[model samples]
Target: MYRWPFISVVLIIAILLVLAFVLNLSIGEVWLNPFQLFFSENLQSAILISEFRLPRAIAAVLVGSALSLSGLMMQTLFRNPIAGPYVLGISSGSVLGVSLVILGGSIFSAEFLSSNSAIIIAALVGGLAMMFILLMVLKIIKDIMTLLIVGMMFGAFATSVSSILQYFSPGFQVKAFVLWTFGSLSKVDYPQIYWMISFIVLALFFVVLSLKGLNLLTLGTSQLEQFGIKTKRLHFIILLATALLTSSVTAFCGPIGFIGVIVPHISKKILKTSNHWRLMPVSMMIGAFIMLVSEMLTHLPGSGMVLPINSVTAFIGIPFILWILFKPLKNEI
Candidate 1:
């Protein structure tokens, strides 16, 4: 009975994913008929479908999958329903990195560092630096609450630095920074997509290996110890994997949110299972579907103006968050 329901949910999500993919490709600035996408003689339409929409769709899938998985891992690690990638401030670290390059370049008149490649590098470096610091602190701290507090402090520090840079930045630099923070799937190109996918795959490999540990962890640290699971070591591995996933998405897509926090809950609610083996794959699918929907909403069928992907996600995510807050207390996973 349980297996059938889980399989049904997977099948439903898979179908929606396919439909979303088709709609994403077909409903851009110029709508292309599904049948004619491959056979269309219009060169401009073909280019739009192949060159532009395809990359954005691919980005949505990868970013959604990475953020959802990362958020699930975090929620599991902290045993908190609300914990998410952005909640830990890793995304802020990336923002600070990008701000330093964009705003700093404008302030110092350094044209060379303002390029897209430089910005990506700076973001990656800043995110990894923050991850390293958090991992180091995790070694000294055993309490999950204390670790969360430390992560918040890191985020606050990064935000303060970003604020200072923004205050000193020129109009154009500030504008650029603001736009990046709004988040986007359209910014990813083919080369960046390749790297993002590679990083996600590697991080997910680590996650798959640790599934049994994750399942044991849900039973509490004592139970984990009883099972011969090295809780500290496993926590390190989970955090490291999460950092890799979160930082890569933030670096490439500029800190997309809500999908991470929302998708896992949606998956758990649907699957009614705490087993990581089941939860992980379901969360990935639901996350990707939500992102595709968000991407579709960003460009309404007839709307000429493109909305920020972040705004659409906020609309979808905030309601769920409020529900979680006000609902009667229950086991989250």
Candidate 2:
């Protein structure tokens, strides 16, 4: 049997990514030719491509790659196959923060929560706060399963608080919050997309720098210490990078889930290696492709009906998670 080279596999994924991107740009309520989207004279077509679909498609790429990278880091950090931002409540923390901004009007300043910047800050603070709490818990509890339960509890608490806030919030505010919870890529426009790109790129840079350290981490902290690597600093960098990527996507894309958990596993299975050098880029491309496909599906093409992005992801994620749960755990990492 013959196998394709790594470079060949990457090139194939790149071509698929390009195709997915063009299809995402073209498929919607009213399909438009990808070529005409660029040079067409129609004002409506220009607006749809430039102002709406383009941003959403780009956002899909960013959200997918960011969440997948974050998930990979988390799985590496914890050495758990199922650990992800959504499963661990980091997204819920972000949701709590955004909820405060959108629904906690009586507690927060009405003027402040109106800006996109404010929402981003609120999400970062909330996500980091949750992460800090989890780390502290990890000190007392070495068992990953217990920590996972704790994370779920934290998510539940955050959701409960958000629910209470919604109870008292104005009808319009409640509606807005509910809509955001549905998780739509369409909510992200040009300005928000720019912020997402900047944050994800920053996180990607840090991940690239720390790839070697992360690989060593898989052997254990003591192994890193054997080589004179600063374990604390490396761990901090990975945690911070994951937080930034996870929070930025949640802040803009409304807590899109499962991309983080599923993408890493898929990448590892395809590449048949634990090496981050190959794992990272492949996971990112696969993630972006999955997200673009999900977005296209959510649009329902000719039916003119739209599905929530989260729903589409959940359909894919739930079964995979069940499979993971039932599979025997191995020392793969």
Candidate 3:
């Protein structure tokens, strides 16, 4: 299913993802070294490492994997290089659902449930609800461009809904919502990171199984159906996986951008092929690398204050997006 040469690239990206995890762990405010684990005297250090940095680092890794894989699925399913997790208003829906819990005007205060996991679960449901709408539209309208437009308009509609909620929300709630928009990986704590990783891993396992189908779909729909592929069923499965993966990440980490939309394109360019068997892991590595680097920048000594994760990502992502606009690929489809 994969060229031997492409497999090498996938293996290299795996190594780099591992290194990115290490870098993410080492450079946080409470800086740590994993080798100190055996020294009982360094128990405090271990606590700081395990309780704080590791969870946040793990959040970055899982969120990165979620976004990257989501992007890969979108690009393949939509048959459009520019498609991303946010395109379908899914994240906007998640944010709006969580905003009700966060923005305590007493109406939705009880909804908070005082659990990060609950908040995440709420957001996931909201995102999936929106995704289901888009999938239904896909069934009704077979035009890819039309589906994209629908997703965008749906996002605008979601934003309007969020704005109305914000109007009645307390100032503190609005501030919290604003912070979520900025997006920080630092919100993850020791205990909950495990859950984030668990869901992300489960979602991705399903996506990976669809790699062969993804490759066939990339070759074009008719070609896949010619080989007895059930295009509609495959599309639903992949889109559902994308919705699950993206919803989980955006629910916890807020709506991250750039890397998801751009990373797959970069992977395709580097691998010189449209093979998802190679592309999936490559996109994950690049996404993880981007997040880890954003995490590292938070440790810049003289910056005085840490920058927002989404801010750094958007800054890095936009230029590449412009480059993509400037240099169209010869045979992207």
Candidate 4:
């Protein structure tokens, strides 16, 4: 089995993240040295850095880390290797929320949904609602497989509703909703990035507090109970943290996928341990690194065409997923 010391893994991923961050900022329409651009006297270069590229790069890091952490926590909570915000329908809930605002013309005014705040609020509300429902279902359903099925049903329901809404929506509103569904990093600006940072920071605090509880959880509820851990409360706090992390990303980035699932698996494989202490930071750094690289790929230098960030991730993700499905699990992390 491949393994590295915890510090070495973190340091290596951190360095990669830094390089990828700089590389992401340097790509796009015109290749410019980002560090040079920052100090350059050219107002045009300054505007491009400060107003556009910088925010997009930061948003990529933020979205990647949030989604990765969310996936890790959910996998731990469910004790399922394949569990994630996207697979479990949490992102679908955010989509439902946004749909109500953008596609539900009879309910929410187009002018009102036009504001970024409204869209963000809608996403958070919808994601939290789904989280709450899943928590309730957890209380009644002891089977993890059944719980996952319920989550998929909820996601399907949300998607079906969004489709129906789209069917009746004005062409402009539908187009706007469709574009948002494509997912984006450039769509997030400075103000939205500030909000995303706040949400992720708060979620990370909860995660730090829940670290021991999460470790206990991986050992099973009986072990946690024997250790005097309050399982239900811990579950709530962890799920809440996941919801906050996932909702913020989906709200701003339009539900980017695969990072949450892939990063954790890769982290586990490299670390060869289940300790949350090591798993958390490594997963985050790896996620951010992947996102930055994905962003750079989406905007290849000298290519006037820019691909949707979601499509790039899917291209990276689908192969990894197929590998996981077919790969031998005798040494599974």
Clash totals for all models, in order?
Answer: 0, 0, 0, 0
| lDDT of every model, 2 decimals | 0.87, 0.83, 0.75, 0.84
Off by over 4 Å in 1: 1-4, 328-333
Taking the tens digit of each residue's C-alpha lDDT, what string does model 2 give over 123-222? 7778878888876776676454576788899999999999999888888788777777778898678888888889888888889878988888677443
- By summed lDDT, the worst window of 10 consecutive residues in model 1 runs over 324-333
* Model 1: per-residue Cα lDDT over 70-105, one tens digit each: 999888888888888777788888988999999998
Q: Which number leads on TM-score?
A: 1
TM-score, per-candidate, Cα-based: 0.96, 0.87, 0.88, 0.92
What lDDT tens digits, residue by residue, belong to model 4 across residues 100-203? Answer: 88888544565667566787789888987998898898778655556678889999999999999998888888888887888889978899999999999999
**Cα lDDT over the full model 2:** 0.83
**How many clashes does the backbone of model 3 have?**
0
Off by over 4 Å in 2: 1-3, 106-121, 128-153, 170-172, 220-223, 327-333
Model 3 alpha-carbon drift over 4 Å, by segment:
1-4, 33-40, 104-118, 221-224, 302-304, 330-333
Instruction: Give me candidate 3's TM-score against the actual structure.
Output: 0.88
Deviation in Å, model 2, residue 102 alpha carbon: 2.0
**Compared to the true structure, candidate 2 yields what TM-score?**
0.87
Which window of 10 residues has the lowest lDDT sum in candidate 4?
Answer: 105-114
Q: On lDDT, who's better, 3 or 4?
A: 4
Candidate 3 displacement at residue 316 in angstroms: 1.0
Q: List the residue pairs that clash in candidate 3.
A: none
Clashing pairs in 2: none
Per-residue error (Å), model 3, residue 80 = 2.2
